[model samples]
Target: MSTANRSVILAETPTAGAAVWTALAGLAVAMGIGRFAFTPLLPLMQHDAGLSLVQGGWLATANYLGYLAGAVICIAWPPAPARAIRWGLVSIALFTIGMGLTQQLWPWLALRFVAGAASAFVLIGVSAWVMPVLARLHQSARSGEVFAGVGVGICLAGLTALVAGMTAAGSQATWLGLGVIAASFALALWRPFSSDGVQATSMAGGARAPLTGQAWIAALCYGAFGYGYIIPATFLPALAHEAIRSPAVFGWVWPVFGAAAALSTVLAMRVLPALSSRRLWAYAQLVLGLGVVAPVFAINLTVLLFAALCVGGTFMVITMAGIQEAQRLGGAQPARAMALNTTAFALGQIAGPLTVSLFNGGLKLPSVLAALVLAASSLTLGLTARASARSAESRQQTEIHVIRDAGDARTNPRFEMS
Candidate 1:
């Protein structure tokens, strides 16, 4: 069917409004499995596949590279963004299946790249679809209960993988489980994704273009956090068991991280309108730094759990806000700013583990993470302050417009008298 027919059908449906939120939630779920859960499972994947650390690193890098490629592809190809997202989810599912069936380094690497690319499409496309509708549907209570799908999926996926790996069922079982989950979501989205996401597409189109200088600073700050946050996310469990000597305790940490993320996203949305994004970013960064690096010194269960909750809860939201702000700054050219931010973040993801690994060559992973967190905290503060200042100016201008409109109304004596 054509776009007009699609729109008309949606307009006629009693459930149209509700369906939009469901589509949004679906996208969030797909993204969580496709993008966020892999890091926690890497150790198992490496052990089962008999892959060396370097090869595992390469596979992770391939995913980031593929994400970068996918972001560009979505802009260049302009496949129905919703459809692209669904297709990407399917690709992730299939590649994950391939991971289960094949163990040779090159094929796994290629599959991971495909998975990464698919993950990008799922995340960007889905967010683009839902963000604008969320913007209009509710101004004060910024809930994306849909986004919670990500947290839930991540929590479940990591919990499953950690348990499977620990049970000595081997890494393949974890991979198989992930494949089943991903494939199921993929097929669900593929069959009727377009009809489900009508409003999401229209909303996505409102994103702005090339970012302001201030926005770039914000992006850089976010990218820096990406560098720091991902190290623990990708390798915390492995570090917990192998480096810190507590596989059992850290196994539980992954789910805690996911649960915290779900809680944080919901709470953050509720609190979004009350404070400026800058304030939130600053506080969130502080929490994240303290959380991720705390494990460096206190290699205990309590500290590990605390760190997982802090970082997992805040990092993704901060990145999401950064992209949204960039779009606000550069109307119609959001793709460039967002791409720049994502690419920088991906580069950081690529760098974080490799850098930590070098230090972990019989040294300390947590120490490296601590140092990076300190740096991230400092940078985030600076950028948050800058963005805050700019926002104040923008709000001031809006206030001026309101005042001028009021003055014009006052001066019109006829209307005033009336």
Candidate 2:
């Protein structure tokens, strides 16, 4: 290649790689540590801190509520995307570290809530921050690389918990170590998220068209995605702990789950061209529902691992596809639509834990409920697709009628005389 061409390629390569990694770091902390660290840590807390399943449910509920609150705030009072993302990263690190400093249940609850909120901001912020750059670079395919950070973070969290479990490090020390890891990631990400992206004035622009009936269905499906995944995502390790009674064995559950999640996103990115986002999302939900129901019928190690893979594999794909569909339907201004879907998702998360709590650790009931919800949502998407097609056909017929009527009016003698 000529020098000019070689220089251009070199510059583009580094910028693209940097953007991808920055997004990965932000997601790892926001999603893996901020959102899901609770999963692996829950078993430890239950073992050492006298935390009950009901209490664990409550704690999960609190985090979901915080996530909901943060989504609401972002929708209502939009901020600069880059700035919001940086602040979210910092807050996640602090709150995660806070988890280690206190043993009081209430304090832990408060910290989890804040961390949850931070994670939501990070998610939204990362989307708003990274998407525009990718759009400009015409490198949108790399979006999957950025989202894979969630799985990476989850893997790390699981590893941290595993080592702690093996050494009998207890919940307190586990929390401290995870916090340190999160904080280090936060520092390393500080310059990238801070200095790399340009600030958008607001994620949500002025009023856009109202959401369509199909969009409403998509939002509901997004919520169902949250509900369907949370139970397995949160409690799998605990179940593994019960079945295996060895940290080494149970620890593998979460890491495997995370590995599946990370791998799934990359695969989806490649496979998505073959399928529409809506169809892919529906199929994923179907798979997820089956996964949720699997553990109910069987409790062996094999069944549990397969279930974890199901949940992990589809959760992120559903999320990415749901948001993409929102953008597709929302047209120029999708921020509001994305936020609405996210809020719906957070609400679903809140409900999942509460539902689990109500059943008093009744795994079958919650799992069955999740499967039904996923199935219903999948069916709803199918109906929405049909409705959209019918609406388009009706509009086409109406336009043809109007054009013929206008042509006749122009050719009429009465109109010609005038």
Candidate 3:
């Protein structure tokens, strides 16, 4: 290659790699520590702080409510993606640290709520900011790497919890450790998420049209996904603890869950490149539904671990595909579309914990209901994809017919317009 060509390659390669890693880090902090660090830490809190399962459900609901609020705000008045991400990360670090500092239930609820909202902002911000850069660089395939950050973060948090559990450290200490980790990640990411040349244009635009039927269905299915995975996502470690009665044994569940989550995205991209986003989401949802119901059928260590793998493996895949579908359906207003879908998802998440709490910490009935919802939504998504395909095909045929008629009119001069 010429010198100029070599220079172009070098510049593009670094930018693409940097964007992917940065987005991945942002998501890891926002999602793993900010949103879900609570999962692995829940058993510790119950052990050390006398926290009840019902209260835990309430705490989880608080966070999900905050996430819903945050997503709604983004839809109403979207902020600059970089600014949102920076502030959200800072807020998550602070809130996570606050969880370690306080003992009161109310304060914990409040801290978790704020942290949840912050996670949403970061999630949307990362999606909006990084996807455009990847698309521009023709590195769209690397989008999976960005989402895998969630799993990586989760794995690290789970490991931290595992170590804390083995050492007999208090929940407060674990929370503080996670906070410090979140802070370090935020510091590393602060400068990178600052305003850059690759402007996140989606943040500035508003939806021109109301959501279509397909968009609504996508949102509904995404909501089902949120509900389907969250029960296991939130309570897997606790369930494992109940069965195994050993922190060393139970701690491995969350880490395994995170590892499966992180690995599944890369594998899916490579193995199922031909599948449409909606179809992939449908399949993943079906698997997640199975995962959700697995432990209910057999509450053993093996079943719990299998449940983790199933739930963890597919949630991010569904998230990635669901968001990509939103972007596709959003037309010029992808951010708004994402916010809407996220709002639906947050609602589903809120319901999950509340369902557990309402049932007095019961899992069987709730798991069965969630599985049914996932199954129905999966079928709907698959059918929706087929309908969309047929619609697009019909439009193409109609356009082709119009072109042919126009050509005939021009050539024969018999059907010509005035």
Candidate with the larger TM-score of 1 and 2:
2
Reference-based lDDT, each prediction? 0.64, 0.82, 0.89
What's the C-alpha lDDT at position 361 in model 2?
Answer: 79
Weakest ten-residue segment in model 3 by summed lDDT: 5-14
Tell me the lDDT of candidate 3: 0.89
> Which should have the higher lDDT, number 1 or number 3?
3
In angstroms, the error of model 3 at 58 is 0.3
- For every model shown, the clashing-pair count is 10, 0, 0
What ordering of candidates by TM-score runs from best to worst?
3, 2, 1
Clashes of 1: 10
For model 2 the TM-score comes to 0.88
- Distance from true location, Cα of 300 in model 1, Å: 2.6
Q: lDDT per residue, candidate 1, 180-217, as tens digits?
A: 88788777666545643443344235333334566567
Per-prediction TM-score to the true structure, in the order listed: 0.80, 0.88, 0.90
